[model samples]
Target: MPKYILFGDYCENALEKRTPYRQDHLEGLKQQKETGILVTIGPTKDNTKVFGIYDAENAEQVTELIENDPYWKNGIWTDYEIKEWIQAF
Candidate 1:
């Protein structure tokens, strides 16, 4: 498997807008965690952006995972970028 980093921007007023889909988003993340795909993820302290690290076979796998997340489907996440990572730790 390869490691990837995800950077996502939230929609305007995401804190308020995300309320309805929060549960589903969390549930999807939980399943991804259990399946060993999502290594770690969270929004920045100010909630300006979302950051995540993923372990997957390829970028497409990670893209599909993110695309299926409720936040993305519901427009809480406006856009995102994925990059193959080289972890030096």
Candidate 2:
């Protein structure tokens, strides 16, 4: 499995609207982890962005996961970047 990192940029009002969608978002990540695709996920200290590590065959798989997220579809996330990660540890 290849490891990749995803960076999600929040919309201007994302924080204000997060409460309603938060549970769904968390549930989605939990499902991904249970399915053995997600490695780890969380927001930055300021909550302006979120970063996730995923285990997938390639960048396309990780992109599909991001595209399927509630946050992405519901407009909470405005943009994203994905890159293959090489863990030294």
What's the C-alpha lDDT at position 87 in model 2?
A: 95
Which window of ten consecutive residues has the lowest lDDT sum in model 1?
A: 65-74
Q: Which stretches of candidate 2 lie over 4 Å from their true place?
A: none
Give the top-scoring candidate (lDDT). 1
Per-residue alpha-carbon lDDT of candidate 2 for residues 12-86, written as tens digits (9 for 90 to 100): 767787778889889989999999999998888887898999999999999888888888888888899999999
> After superposition, which runs of candidate 1 have C-alpha atoms over 4 Å from their true positions?
none
Strongest candidate by TM-score: 1
TM-score of 1: 0.97
10 residues in a row with least lDDT, candidate 2: 11-20
